[model samples]
Target: MKYLMEFEPIIKKSSSLSPHTFSGLAGVCEYLAEPRSKEELAALFKTCHTNKIPFRILGNGCNLLVRSAVVPGVVVKLTNPAFCGFENLGNTVRMGAGASIFSAISFCSQNNMAGFETLIGIPGTIGGALLSNTSDKSGPISRFVRKIEVIDSLGIIQIRDKEEISFSDKGNDLRDPVILSVEFAFEIDKTESIVKRLRKAWISRKIQLPLGVPYAGKIFKNPRGLTAASLMEQGGFQKTKVGGAEICDRDSNYIVIHPNAVVEDVLRLIEQVKQGIRERFNVDLELEITIW
Candidate 1:
């Protein structure tokens, strides 16, 4: 419903490709995905199985950089309306995994929910955040998760409580469960203070991330006791470029997508950057963005 008014314009702006980055993304996904309830999701998966058709799940694509190469199967952008719902539960919030983290932070601030101020400018969905275990190793998104609802590959919906979910000290999730929704426990504080903190986070993000570019935020994850951005700068990989992909001079933490940059070009640059860093510092860089 709302997607018709909001995402269709974006769909039109982005041209379709044969085998794009996502296994099921861009033209193929945009044309086929129709968000529904759990039952509908199951039915859709059933249809895919019965027809011997292929399909895959995709979220906001914020953490994704799809290749120009395409995936043959049907693309599933989990836009299930139910997956976008946000509910207040005492000191917690139950949200659809599809709900944008940025939006969630704003809502929490408006409602005076604290503990999420640090996430104010982060652009991702609840599910993506959890899978990435977004954090600086002190804690992860799974740390705040009280429960997770997910649809397995079998198309069955299940919920995992906090105790059922566990994380590595390095901030990685052991489970490969496909998250459907999540219940986030939060601290309560004064609305004004939280809002102020949010503003501060936003300002910080604006300075660090290249907001106007088409690039995905972070290209590589920070290694133990080291920052990815810092490493890149040390080796002077900041000025490197592949096709139209370039390391943002303003912030080595981000890669800026020049006008008409293809997916392969971005991937090439990422590899080059990784190699450069390793050659100079002897550290293997881990990629942060999920290549679809």
Candidate 2:
């Protein structure tokens, strides 16, 4: 308690805990800390770790769901501009973990970086994308990740090369490390070519993903050879609503939450959808969104 009180000046209380996640869902957290620099972040991590304080890292929050109105621990957000920067090398780019996927794509297009054009429409920060192994038809973001820099619970910084890491459909095996930055490798291409690819990726996403809704990205990952969207459609989940949370008729994979929706409503709908899918297809769907 004394250690936590020491953060009284540096950390914000519940009233100031509004997160910038895409869902626009309000949550109640005890303490929220936004470190302006890596040194500050490390100091905070050190204190929390040494004192055994529970903490959760909050990224762009695009693919997250706040399941409980009152979160139990400290929330760490790295949205400071200092944590969001990019450096261009000849064939690779060093990107801060806080940088948005859109920003990375724009940089790639402008620099004629070819490989990442497929990531244009992905939401959230680079750190979130990497942690979730975000991908589309082309590939996962892990494919472009040459190296990752992270800080451990002890606030010790380390760098892991691609070979030293493993990523799967479940997500990256990051050992719960706080990602500092990622170095991405890309091929040189004509700026026009990169632009064309970026346009195509954007158009494809606009068509397949739900639009004009307050949602937390995808609800479930595709199960093996079957698509979650099609399964939801087949399971008769379209237009299904549990309180203010409803399955998007346009895209069965997305659950749109109304302004009045509570976390329980969203969670209940998810259970119903999952149960329906299990009964019909005999497949247990894995959730893609992080329930914080």
Candidate 3:
């Protein structure tokens, strides 16, 4: 606890009680460290490593699921403005990992950048999106990422080009690296055209996905050529409920929680849905959200 005292000025105790996750559900955590810069993050990691204090990186928390049991160790969140800088290159846009996807999309629209319009309604920061391989049928984030900057396990900075990385259905194939920034490549287009395309994408998103609800985007990944939402709906999970967590009436892929929904309720509901899908369709479903 001595080293933790060193971070007292920037660390929040009992972070799990009021987690930053979109689910608004969490158990108590020992600490939450908010580092304002790359240097601060490195220092925090180094100290934690030396002290053997476990830690996990947190972003916009749009795709995370915290358990009901108290989480031991620190939860590190990169939220400082220093980690949200944006730069526009001729054919590339550079952004800090802490920058939100909405901000990036807005930047692209204003700068007449094309190819990222499909990512309009997605949540989470740039780093979280990259880590989750955020994308749709059009393409994954890997498609536009030209280069990625990260802090390795040893608290050292490193950069990897697009070709150097590998992506899978689960997400980007990162080997325990903490993403610091990303440079995305895009095509230049007319500002009007970009705005039109972005607007269309947003409208489509609003129609297909649930809005004004406390729900995690998608609970399961689409398997192969089939969509998970379709499978869930076909399996009759649309009106299913486990305690206060239930499948969204509008979007079968989303799981909406009531004001008093507990973490166990959501977990049980996910299990029930997955089991039903497997039993009915003989297809295994993989979860898209990270269960912490």
Candidate 4:
């Protein structure tokens, strides 16, 4: 409670988190801090560290699902212009962690830079994408990452190169509490070619995934050598529903939330799906979305 006064200028008490996420289903967090600059963020981090208070970073919230219970500690969101900057550096681009993935892809496409087309339709910020190693058929975003600036739990900043970080389908190895910025290397290409490819990728995603739906992206990661959606369909989970949450008719891998949905509805549906898949296919489905 004493620390609250230290950052009172940037902290909101007992704030609802539903509007921050794509699913629009979440409870409240004890403290929500929106620091206007890096210095303020570092100071806040240091305070939390010294006080032993738990904290988590929030991005675009496209792939997050928060529980209905009140979340204690701090939730940090980097929405200020200082943290959402974008810069073009010829063969490479420098992006603040708060920059949206759509903006990054569009910037690269307009500048005739290639390599980000594979993530055209994905939502969330650059930091969240990198943290989860977001990818499609082409590859993970880590492939283009040249380096990243991050703040460790101790509130110290460090630079990590591509070689220094390891990425996989599971996630990245960067244990830093905050990603400040990233430099991504890209190949030179014609603007028309890049835009054409981007358009194709976006259309393909819109067709396959559950677009324009009240869902929090994919609920489960594809098991090795198998797709989660196919497994769910095979398991007869298409009509499965728990409260106001139900398997998306467009894509069984996604759970659509109705107006009356609560976080418990989604959690229960996820558990049921996991249980059924485990029983039917003997495979343990891993979650892709972050549950807070």
Candidate 5:
């Protein structure tokens, strides 16, 4: 009860919009604390930690879908603070975990940073992406990260300078740690050429991913040799609907949502598709969305 009060004012002004996952659709968080400065972040973390308050660090909320059940914890959102910006240093660039992936790409492009352009289609903050190892053939989180700075549950800060500081295959994004920033390596290139490529990449991403609807990106990972989307299509799961969730007709890969769609709909559809794919293809599809 007391913690609720401390988290109240902050919740009233947090961002709206939640994604879908195994759980049902949920309300916007009770509170959202957007700490822009390191001091603010420290204070927020210190206060919540000291009081034993429940909280989750959030990036853009693009990859998450909290259930409709009242969320009992506080959400910490990193805003457009200077602390989240990037700076060029030698062959690498330091990126604030709070910065949006889109912004990071732009920053890199303006500064002639390459490699990260392949992540142009990914939607989420750098922190979320890093935590999730957001990438594909371009390599997940390992290709660019030179070092990760994180704050542990005990509020102790640590820096891992080498690869293998991961939590899963392609390793962890230091998920358990509250990431502050990461240093990435990039090459020098023509600004005009970089921007041109970036623009093309963005357009391509739009075509590949269903961008017009409320989605948490792809819901499943392909089993080894096959693509999840292809499996769903082969299983005839396209345009399928449960509640507010519907297999996007525009693309077999997406779960299109209506304004009234609840969390259950998406969850149901995903499960159905998964079961169907497994039964038909004999391959279990792994879910990509993190559900809580």
Candidate 6:
């Protein structure tokens, strides 16, 4: 605990994590550190590693579902400009891990670069997207990734090529504790064409997703050839509700929260849907969101 004092300017003890996540329903964390630079991040990581303290990297928290129980760990948020910068190259763009997916897409569109339009409506930072292999029907973000810079659990920096990484529907194989930056290769296209594609993607997502709702993310991943939303509808979970959490009428795979919703409400609803689907269709649903 005394080590935290060394970085007092960046450390907040027993901080509420609700505002950091999209769900806005989390409890407090033992320590929330917002390191301003890579050096500070490395030092903080080293301190946590040496002290055997649990360390977690938080991005935009778009797909995170933290419980109401106090989370015991050092939650590192890369919000400083030093960790959220963007560099434009000729055909490739290097973006800091902390940069939002929307920011990256905007930069690409401005530079007349194509490919990122597929992720138009997706939230979260580039680091989280890469770690989760965030994608839709078009393709995964991994397809454009050329290299990644990361900080391992021991606070050592390393650069990994695309060949060294493997991505699946579950996520990526990179076990690094922190992603520092990502280099992406894109095609040169007209700015109008790129914007048009982005618009189309955004509209498509808006129609399918439960936007403008208090939700962490999609509750479950599509089970192979079958979509989770259709299955939930078929299982008659559209009208299901627990406390202030209910299955979104627009999309059954999402559990939207009301103003008074608690984490337990969402948890119970998830369990109910999982159990119902298992009993009716004999299919085990896997969660797409990360629960902390």
Q: Each model's C-alpha lDDT? A: 0.67, 0.82, 0.83, 0.87, 0.70, 0.87
Residue range with the least summed lDDT across 10 consecutive positions in model 4: 208-217
Scored by lDDT, model 4 comes in at: 0.87
For residues 147-204, write the lDDT of model 3, one tens digit per residue: 9998888888889888888986568678755899999988889988888888888888
TM-score of each: 0.83, 0.92, 0.94, 0.95, 0.84, 0.95
Candidate 6 lDDT over residue span 33-57, tens digit each: 9999988999999998898888899
Predicted candidate 1, C-alpha RMSD: 5.6
* Model 1 TM-score on a 0 to 1 scale: 0.83
Please identify which of the two predictions, 3 or 5, would achieve the higher TM-score against the true structure: 3
- Please provide, for model 4 over 108-169, each residue's C-alpha lDDT reduced to its tens digit, 9 standing for 90 to 100: 88787898976887888999988888888788888899999999878988888889988887
Root-mean-square deviation (CA) per prediction: 5.6, 1.9, 1.7, 1.5, 3.5, 1.5
Name the better of 1 and 6 by TM-score: 6
Better of 2 and 3 by TM-score: 3
Better of 3 and 4 by lDDT: 4
Error of 6 at 247 (Å): 1.2
In model 2, pairs of residues that clash are none
Task: Residues 1-292, candidate 1: write the lDDT tens digits.
Answer: 2323432422222235333332122333333454566666666665555566655566666667766345444455556567777899887899888888877877788788876777766667778777777763235666677888876666677777778656643345535335778898887889888878767877877777646556555678778888888888988888688887788887786777777666676778888888888788999988778765
Report the C-alpha displacement of residue 161, candidate 4, in angstroms. Answer: 1.1
Error of 3 at 37 (Å): 1.4
Candidate 2 residue lDDT tens string, 157-270: 888898988887668778845898999998889998888888888888788764666785588988888889999998889989999988988788887878888778888999
Which residue pairs overlap in candidate 3's backbone?
Answer: none
